[model samples]
Target: MNEQTVTRDERAGEEAADPNRLLPDEDPSSHDPDDARHWLEVYDELLDFKRKMLTIAEEALDGMRDKPARREVVDTDRRVLRAECDRFEKRLAFWRNRLAAARDGKGP
Candidate 1:
């Protein structure tokens, strides 16, 4: 198969694996507005929590600045926080897109 076909198959497999995956052609009218609102609120709260966690991670790294011996541990912590932040960002984007799609009467 060509690259595009392979990629499409892979994406399909991924969607199959992820129960929460939203299809582009899915009927948005079937979804409840109230549920969407609640999910938006929940996602907002999670994003806020992620921001707070990132702040705490930064503070922890700042505290470790004076202790050279623990630099490796701090670095590892920073990496973990960076990954967590990345995931949070992706999730936020997903929710924002989903909301927009719902508002536009399109699938997310």
Candidate 2:
């Protein structure tokens, strides 16, 4: 499956598994303070995970470059990791904005 398809499938599974999954347009004010805090914590964890993945991918790419036989594998892995990082970055941005709006009393 393509990256977009995989991302959608993953999101669907996550939402199914955790009904509290946050969406981009979620109104943070609708949730209690504790719930909003929990969501922020989750976002932090996911962001950290993506950062670590990006680091590992970069390291692997660097190491694999020395082994000509693994060029394709390295490239594929890098692409996947980068895509995951990008996805997480976008999610984090959305959550941050939502949190800010809620804090500013501009959220619904």
Candidate 3:
């Protein structure tokens, strides 16, 4: 092929081999606003659940505190409830982190 023809072919090949040109990337944060909003809502719901669990745990402990005679039973129930509350609180924290990551355009 002539030098001009070879150059044109090489340019065409380079364009075809361009990865970004072939597969464009859409910003995760820009793909869907509704998706981000949905995640935020999920995080909020988890926070609400965590709050309710803590309240329940506090009530259980308060009840146990008032009754020394039934310490074993009350304490056991309180312990179980407190553990559950902790788990829910952790979940809330995780969701909050995920929401933050999404906002910052990072991984969830």
TM-score of each: 0.53, 0.57, 0.41
| Model 1 weakest 10-residue run by lDDT | 19-28
Candidate 2, residues 3-72, lDDT tens digits: the string is 9999998886555344345556556455344455666677678768867876876666666655864676
Local lDDT at 76 for model 1: 58
TM-score, structure 3 vs. true? 0.41
Regions more than 4 Å wrong, model 1: 1-32, 66-69
Q: Tell me which residue pairs clash in candidate 1.
A: none
Q: Sorted by TM-score, highest first, which candidate order results?
A: 2, 1, 3
Q: Rate the local accuracy (lDDT) of all candidates.
A: 0.60, 0.63, 0.53
What is the lDDT ranking, best to worst?
2, 1, 3
> For model 3, what is the alpha-carbon lDDT of residue 98?
57
Best-performing candidate as measured by lDDT: 2
Checking candidate 2 for backbone clashes, the offending pairs are: none
Q: How does model 2 fare in lDDT?
A: 0.63
lDDT of 1 by residue, 1-108 (tens): 899999998886455345354435433344555555655566567658767876886777766766864586466555555555565456556656667777788863
